[model samples]
Target: MTNDLRARRLALLKEHFASEVAQEFDRTIATFADSPRYEIMPTGQVHDGEDQVIAYHRAQRTAFPDQRHENVRFHVADDDSIIAEFDLLGTNKGEFAGGAPTGKAFRVPTIAVFFFDGERLVNERVYLDSASMLRQIGRMDLLG
Candidate 1:
């Protein structure tokens, strides 16, 4: 029974990412618990509610509408939280972080630890290299 539950939860998580890669924001929104959150570690930013999460997604996708994860691999933790490692691929075809597009592509290695309460996802803590991403996108000069 426990294994069954674990598989179901993991399946839900994978499907969540599938929706996100498809740019199905509404579907991505449906995957969360009522008050889900995302903590982006590199940027020290947290989107703490559904609205904030929506805005964050909008901003990112607006900048890189083709953004997606590739070579995804998932590891199930002892606490049932799934840790996802993937390559974040995207082209900066639109404004990002209030800066004009460089129309460059970046491939950033990323890891996102998904936290769950029972079968509901409560939080996702993402670890990524902002410097590498910025440099690839022609924004390294902004790094000072």
Candidate 2:
């Protein structure tokens, strides 16, 4: 039987993904605790608190307006974290950082570690390769 903590964590994770897929980002943000945080390892970018997290998502959408994820699997990592393996697929249909839209696509594997402080998600750290993703999106120069 799942402990109450585990159950709440699992449910939060589910709702998080479901809300994202449904394009209901506001609902997705509701799943987070009062102070939410997100860390992108490759770029050393950190979004802390609700406002920063929202800005982070906006920048992400500006780079890949149609970004979506497919969960490959998930595992409980101790009592406070859940590791989710997924594929992050998206098209470069919108400007990314300083680069213009390429109209290319990228499908890359990613692992996101979701951290919880007893049922409320406090942080999410995602690991992925920027070079490969850039190459997949028709940016061979970024690979150089």
Model 2 agreement with the true structure over 7-81: per-residue lDDT tens digits: 778889989987776667788788887787899999899999878888888777878878889865889876678
What clash pairs does model 1 have? none
For each candidate in turn, the TM-score is 0.95, 0.90
Model 1 lDDT tens row, 16-124: 8998888787788777777869999988999998789889988999999999999999888888588999999999999988799999999999999998878878899
lDDT for position 86 in model 1: 97
Q: In model 1, where do residues sit more than 4 Å from their true spots?
A: none
> How many clashes (backbone N, Cα, C below 3 Å) per candidate?
0, 0
Best candidate (score: lDDT): 1
lDDT of 1: 0.89
